[model samples]
Target: MNQPLHLMTPEVRANPYPLYAELRRRPVCQVEPGGMWAVSRYDDVVTVLKDARRFSSAGLGQSFRPPWLEHNPTADSLVMKDPPDHTRLRTMLSRAFSGSALSRWESSIRAIAEELAEATVRRQEVDFVAEFAMPLPARVLNLFYGLEPSMALRLKRWADDLVSIPASQPSPQRMEEIRHSLAEMERCFNALIEARRASPGEDLVSELIRTEALTHEELLGFLFGLVPAGVETTVYLLANTMYVLSEHPREMERVRDNPALIPRLVEEVLRYEPPGQSSLRLTTEDVELSGVTIPRGAIVIALMGAAMRDESRFPQADRFIIDREAQSNLAFGHGPHFCLGAMLARMEARLGLEALFSRIRGFSLQRRDFAWSQSIIARGPLTLPLHLEPSRR
Candidate 1:
């Protein structure tokens, strides 16, 4: 048998596609350290995501409830539940992310993007991830929940700790940090929930409170999951978009010349270098995929990064093609648990890129080698230094 893929290694975390390609050949193979099964092919990954009965989402709950985190809200959130529980929870929260609801924030989102873009370009050289990518979504989320700007720093730190939990074994200090973040997040959200109960407002938290569909704990769980889901994913998306444009000058010119192409560019970037790398699932029955039999009760990983670049599904899967034929990608996940904030994420990326491109002629990477985020589940530059050129117009 081939050596099991060591997913948590720094090299694999940095650039996993080559290893994913090798695993895709087998389609269903063992991932080491934990001895979990990995599903790498597009069809196989979809099957695992869609067939929630055969592949239970409770595996996600397991990931969220690590030793250090005694009680992570995500462990009880919708993403970790299967129907009819998942269906019911999803129905309750669906309205918050509906088109009409999101439409209300369009102008606000654009304004935030424009303001941040102007501020970023004024510096000429800055860490794009810190100045632009991180704050755009963080601010938008604050607006959504009616949070104070002062709370953003804490939210960012909590989000970082939350997502980093499953990446690797945390050191004692890191473990303590994660525990502290969880406690602080719970305390903060508890206050917000009570405040919303006392006097509801126009924000989503108030709306959710008005519905009375979720219990206090459920509400807290949903908000806890939202910090990382709503903020960090979009942060990675925006940062990845900038990184892609810097590397592909022609694509950057294409976008600069015609801003309408920004949406297409975003889609392509999602497929090319998605913010999320993989999702975890557990098998409820003996499952046979691509001629390999995975026993019941085994942990399965849906390798989205590999599946998005499946040679059969996407031609020239390695290259960054701005105008690739439009098709669904697993960047936002698939099936019943499809990312609830996908619309918001896409909008943030679109407007964020538009705001930046309109003000800057172009941008180039200040350094060729940069650090990637530590999370194995998500992928993006930790700090992207860029030198921006102001538009002549």
Candidate 2:
């Protein structure tokens, strides 16, 4: 297993489990060419994610943030903060993103899912990524932030760029594109915030506007984090769930028959094939793990996808089984920085799957050949082409 498992490799991108299984033999393997440590096993990944004091999330790409974003209040979001600061930011922002708030949107989310499913079925042959998976989260977020549906497309573009930039070392041209996207996002959010201030709406943005805990600058920066948080990963989650279910006919049939199990199916997909493969963290101080020493200021990557498949934590971890007992999966992350939108992501996915199966019968992949996104940070089919059959009423 001497072959490189660098972030951008095709082998790791296409299917990374075998590589992960090999790397887990050594809980922490130093990835050469870049000198970063890869923590693969479940325990180590948890240790890195949970012990924020030892491993900081702030310095993932020290050179990446452009001046505009560098000064934004959200620049120090929950994702990039450690302990006290992270705790405080999460608490203030959690008010509008609380469980009750998320539950209130369930009916509307289901309706959106139903409408998307109907449209997808009418298309007969469609790319699930573009048609259902992508827009589903965007539209739901639109409703959440009180933005018009027209903003979904531009927001999706901004979010896709935002999520991808930090993970890879982009060329100068790509960096400019990312900066431009960030500027556009900042401008768009600022306008929305001002509108919410003028005439408060029954939405998350308006609610946050009313809060005194976060200043306008901080609120704007947090919104930058929120767009991608609410959109990108969930988009991949929905896409991956559909691909897995369609591949596993028995499981698909079971969920289609018993719609209640749709949530369980979503969980299994998160474990079996997480949307986010890894997250970057910086070592705050020297630390030793599983006999390997990580020097101070070293880059540490927690392989969430690999950890979810750790045999010690998960029985038959490689397989996707919906009925498995409840176990913590790292897909939505762990520790204090656990995803704020996890509840919303789950609702959209569960509802989206239910709507698809209920309205469209004989739904199947149009082709077996598919290309996975070449991003080590996330994993899913880039284009999920499928044929949707009419309902068998």
Candidate 3:
């Protein structure tokens, strides 16, 4: 038997594509540490995503509520629910991202993007992640929720610790930090929910409260789940877009010359170096996939990174072709649980890139060596230093 893949290892976290390719050959097999099944092929991954009956989303809750961690709000969030419950939660939250709502926020989003991009380029040489990528989403989220600026850094720390739990083998010190962060998040969000209840405003929290659809616990779960889902994913998306463009100057020039292609570029980046690498699922019953029978109650991970690169689905699957015909990819997931923040993430990327390339002629990586986020579920550089060339026009 082949040695099971240890996904959390530093090397794999940095670049797992080569190993992903090897796994695709087997298509469905067990991975180590937890003996979870990894579904790597495009068809099989989609099969797992679409068939919520046979492959349940409860695996998310299982993954989140480990023995060491306390009961996480995410364990009961919409992402972990099945059928009627998931549908109800999704309905309550859908209005916030509706067309009119996004239209209202578009100008603000662009303004923030332009301001941050201008500041980053003014530096000429900087860690792109810190100066631009991280702040764009963080600021956007803060504004959307009407959160105080004082809470931004604390919220980010809590989110980082929360999302990293499933992926990290935390030391005692790290465990304490994670626990404390969780407690702090619970306290902060509870207060926010109550404040909105007493006197609502035009912000998302107030908007949700006006609906009067979700219970207090449900509201807490939704807000708790939103931080990591909303902020970290977009941070990675923006950073990965820059990393891809920096490495492929021709594509960068193409996009800079024709800004209309920015959306396409973002789409291709989502397929090529997706922020969320996999979706967690549980086998509700014995399920046969790729000729392998997975037992009931098994943890199955749909490898989005591998599926997006599956040769059968995408031509020149490994190449970063920005104009590759706009076929669907599992970067933001699919079916009932498709990322609710898809529009917001795409809008931020499009505007962020427009703000960036409009000011800078081009950019190149200052150093080839960099660290990737330690979380197995997310992918992107922790620090991306770049030498940016200002636009001459």
Candidate topping TM-score? 1
RMSD of each: 1.3, 2.1, 1.5
Q: Give the TM-score of candidate 2.
A: 0.94
The digit string of per-residue lDDT tens for model 2 on 261-355 reads: 98888889999999988888899889999999999998888999999999999999988889999998999888888888887788888888888
- What candidate 1 gets wrong by more than 4 Å, as runs, is none
Worst 10 residues of 3 by lDDT: 149-158
**The 10-residue segment with the lowest total lDDT in model 1:** 161-170
Q: For candidate 3, lDDT tens digit of each residue in 40-76?
A: 9999988899988998986668667889986788788
How well is each residue in 1-393 modelled by candidate 1, as lDDT tens digits? 577778878888788888998998888988875898999999999999999899998666877787766778878877888988889989999999999999999999999999999999999899999999999999898888898987876788888888777735888998888888888888888898889889989999999998888988888888888888888889999999889888899889989989999999999999989998888888999999999999999989898999999989999999999888898999989999999999999999999999999998888999968988877678999999999999987
In model 1, how many backbone clashes occur?
0
Candidate 2 lDDT trough over 10 residues, lowest sum: 67-76
Model 3: lDDT equals: 0.88
Given candidate 1, what's the lDDT at residue 369?
83
Report lDDT (CA) for all predictions.
Answer: 0.89, 0.83, 0.88
